[model samples]
Target: MQSQNELRNLLQRIDHKSYPAYKDTRGSYDFGNYVLSIDHVQGDPFAAPSKVSVHVRGGAAKFPADLYRMKCRRLAVCDYLLRQFGQELERVSFKAKGSGKSGLLAVSRPGQEVLERTACQMDEAKGDLVLRFEVGFPANGRTVNARELEKIFFTFLPECVSHSLFYKALDEKAVYRAADLAEDQQYIRDHLKEQGLVAFVADASILPRESGVSGRPMKDAVKFTAPESMKVSFALPHAGKIQGMGIKKGITLIVGGGYHGKSTLLKALELGVYNHIAGDGREYVITDDTAMKIRAEDGRSIKKVDISMFINDLPNGKDTSAFRTEDASGSTSQAANVVEAMEAGAETFLIDEDTSATNFMIRDELMQRVVNREDEPITPFIDRIRELYEQYGISTILVAGSSGSYFHVADCIVQMNRYKPQEITAFAKEEADRFPLPEVKPPKQAAPTFERAVRPDRAFKEDARMKLKTMGRDGISINRDTIDVRYVEQLADTEQLAALAYFLKYAEIHVFNGKRTLRESVSLLMQYVEEHGLAAVTESSYVPCGLAMPRAQEIFACINRYRRISL
Candidate 1:
C-alpha cells in the first residue's frame, strides 16, 4: 500500500512525461478516509476512462449493519449512495482539464428501477463498502498532465467520498428511509404468494409514464384507485396498514377502451418485480418476482423449446415437441416466449394485446367454426389460460382491448374506465355468458419439457473463447451473432442487459455442458449469481461498474433469442 503523499510525489515526478507515465499511478493508496485503487489505466485519454474504486471500511463510512442486513435493503442503500456519489462527482467533475477526455469523472448512473448494480456494494459482515467508477486521466495530447490528475485523486475525489459515502456527512434520515422502504417492499413481496396474490398496485400509485420514451411517472397523472371488491390490505413491516388492489393468483384481465389505463396499469405490473425510489409513485406497486412480460417476437430464433402445449400438429411435419425455428411467425414466437418464461420459473405472465399476436391470443367463434379444428394447428391462449392456471399453477394478467374472449377464462376482471380500475368480474361474467366462448380441443401434453441438449456451435468455440457485448438496451452480440430481446419488455436498463451478456458468457464457459437442460443450466447460473454477485460473471474476476443484476427470466430470454444456440 502507498500513502497519499507518496502518490502525490509520484505524480509530480511523472509530470510532463509521456502518457504511459500515468500507468504508474495504477495502485492502492491509503488516503486517511478511504483507500483508492486504480484497477486499470487507459492507454490514452481518448480511450475509455480508467477503471477506479474507492474502499471504505472499519466504521469509516458509518452505514449500519442492521439497515443492510437484508440483501434487498443493502441494494437500496447502495443505489442511494451511488446516486449521492454521482451527484458529488458532478460538482467537481472536469473542473481540472487537459486534452481529450482528460479530468472527466463518472459512475454508472442508476434509473427509476432500483437494481442491484456493481456501481457500489457493501459487505456488512466485513464492514466493507466499495464504490467503483471511472476517471479520464489528465493528459495534454500524448503528454501527461500529472498536476491536473493530482487534483482529481488528492482533492476532488476525497471531498466527494467524504460527502457521499460517510454516514456522518450524509442525509441520515433519507438513508434510513430508503432502507426502511426496501424492508417494506421486501415484506410485501414475501407475503404476496402467501396472500394468494400475484401482484398489488398501491392506492394513489402513478402508472402512466411521462412519455413513450421516458420511464418516469407522468406529472400529475391520474392516481390508481382500486374498487371495493378488488381492494386488499397489507400491514407492511415498515409502512403500516397499506391498502391496494390485490391481483389474485389466477387469470386476470385488464379491459378498457383505447387511451384508458389498461396497458399503463399492466406496464406498472411489468416492472413491479423491482422496488422503486420513494417518490417514483410505484414504490408499493409490486408483482411476483418470477413474473415475466411475454410477447410475440417475430424473427427470433428458438432452440428445442417444447411449445407443443400451445401450438402443435404442424402442416410441414416439423416437431413441435422439441421445436426449432430460425425465423418464427408471430404466433409461434409468442408460444416460444411463454414456454421460455415458464422454463425460467415465471409464475405470472403479463401480456399486452398491443404486443401479442392476435391469432395466438384468441380465435372468435366465427373464425373457429369456419376454420374447423382439423385445419387449425395452433391452440390460442384462450384455451390454455384456464388449464395453465388450474393444472400448472401458472397465472396470467393480460391487457386486452380488442377482445372479451379472455373474460370467459379470467378469474378476476378489472375494467379500467378513464384510468380508474373497477372490479367488474360479475359484469364481465354476465356479458360473457350471453356471448359463449368458442370451443377448443386441448393439447395432449400436460406441460412442455424444458430440458434440451444445448451447446455452442463448434466453430464459434474455436474462433473465440468469448466475444460478447450488450447492444444498448435492446439486444446482445455473442460471437457476432445477435440475441434480439427488444420484445422482452421487462428489461429495465442497459446495465441489466450487460449483466445478461456476461451471464450468458459465464454460462457457456462454466455451466453449459452437452447434457445440462436449459432450466438446469440457468438455475446453476443464477445460483452462482446468488452466491457471488454479478462480479463473478466477469471471466477475469474483475468487478465492473456497468453491470446490474438481471432476473433469471431475462437470462432465459437472452439465451432463447440467441441465434447461435444449438442443440
Candidate 2:
C-alpha cells in the first residue's frame, strides 16, 4: 500500500492532467487510522461516481463483541452505521469545488425498514470493518482537478471515518440501544411460534403514514390501541413489559367501512416482515418473517405452477395442475401468486381486497346461483381459507370492506372503525350463523410437492448473457423481457430488487440444474448467502455497496415473474 503522503505527491504530479489521470489512483492507500481502497474510477465526472471503500481495523474501530456476535445484531449495527456514515458524507459532500458532479460523495440511503445492506460490513474475527460508497472524482471540464480530490481524500474522508466507523467516537448509549433493540425484536420473533402468534402490533404504535407519497409517520394521527380481549403482553429484555395485539396463526379477517383504516392496518402488517429503525413508527409491529402480500397480477406470465387448489376446470381445458399462460386473467394470476407464495415457504398471507381479484377472493350466494358450479372454474379463496390453515398450517390475514363471506371461515375477526381495531369475532360469527354459509368444494389437491423446473425460454436459451437491471422497485428488465413486480406489495426498496437481479444472475450461472427443484435451488443459494454475503452475488473482486439483502420470498417472486423462464 502507498503511504498517504505518497498519494498526495502522486495527486500533485497528476494535477491539471487529462481526466484519465484519475485511473492511476485506483489502488489502496495506507492512512494512519484506516486503509482507503479506490476500487473503480469513473472516466467522466458526470458518469456514475467512482467506487471506493474504507477499511478500519477492529483495534481502531473498537466496537463491542456483542454488537456483531449474532447475525441479527450484526445486521442492526451495520444498518445503524450506514445511516451514520451517510449523514457524515452529506455533511462534507461537495466541500471541494469543481465541475460536473465533482467532489460529490454518497452511500446507499436507507428508508423506514432496517434491511441488511452491503453499504457497511463488520468482520471482527477478520479484524476489519468495511464501508463502501461512491465519490465523484474532482474534474474541471474534462481535466483532472487532483488537488481538490486530494483534499476530499485526506481531509473530508478522515473525518467521516473517525466519527462514523469508530464506536468510541459515537454515542455509547445510542449504539448499545440499537443493538439491544435488535435483541428485543428477535425475542418477539423467537416466541411468536411458541405463543401461536403470526403477528404482533404494539399498543400506541402509530400505524398511519404522513401521506400516500411518504413513508414517515403521520403527525397527530390516532395511535393504535388493541381491544382488551385481544391484548397480549411480552417481557422484552430492554423495553420490559409491553402489551400488544397478538394475531394468532389462523384465518383472520379485517373488515370495516371505507376509509376506516382497514387497509392501513393491513399495510402495516405487510411490511412487518422487516425490522424498522427507531422513530419510524410501527417499530414494534412484527409479522411472520415469511409472510407474503398476495395480490392479483393481470397479464403476468406464469410458468408451470399447480394452482388447482384454488383454480381448476378451465373452459379451455388447459391443465390447472401445471398451469402455464403468457397472459393470465386476474383470478388465474392471483391463484398462481398464492401457489408461488406457498412454493416459497411463506407461512402467512397478507391480502388487501383493493389489490386482489374480486372473483378469486369470494363468490357470493347470488353469484353462485347465477353462475352454476359446473360452469364456474375458480373455487374462490373464501371456500378454501379454512383448509389452508387447518390442513396446511398456512395463516391468512385478509382485509375486506365489502364482503362478509369470509366471516364463516375466519377464526378471528377484527373490525376497524374510524382508525381503531376492535375484536368482533363472536359478533360476526353470530351474524353468519343466522344465514348459514353455502357449501363449497374442498381443496382439489393436498399440499404440493413444490417441484417446479426452471429452464430458459426457447428464444433466449441460445443467448450467452442477459442484460439484467432493476426498474426501480416495480420491475426488473432481463434482456428484452420485463418481470413486473408492481403488485408484489412486500418489496420495499429498489436496492432489494437490484439484489434480486444479481441473485438470479448468480443462480442462472451456478445453482439451477436439470434436476433441482426451485425450492432446492433457492435453499442452496441461501446457504451461499449465509456463508458469504450479498456482495458475493456480484461475483466480483471488489465488494459492491449498492445491494440490500432481500428475503427468499422476494427471490422466489423474482423468478416466478420472469417471462423468459420456461416450464
Go through the candidates in order and give each one's C-alpha lDDT. 0.87, 0.87
Per-residue lDDT for 83-166 in model 1, tens only? 999999988889989888898999988889999998899985855899999999999888999999989998899989988998
At residue 486, candidate 2 shows an lDDT of: 87
lDDT of 2 by residue, 355-437 (tens): 99999998888888998987888888888788888887899999988888888888899999989999999999999898887
Give the TM-scores of the predictions, in the order they appear. 0.98, 0.97
Q: How many residue pairs clash in all the candidates, one count each?
A: 0, 0
- Flag clash pairs in model 1: none
Question: Candidate 2: global Cα-lDDT?
Answer: 0.87
Q: What's the lDDT for residue 399 in model 2?
A: 94
Q: After superposing candidate 2, which stretches have Cα over 4 Å from the reference?
A: 124-127, 456-466
Model 1 spans with C-alpha error above 4 angstroms: 457-465
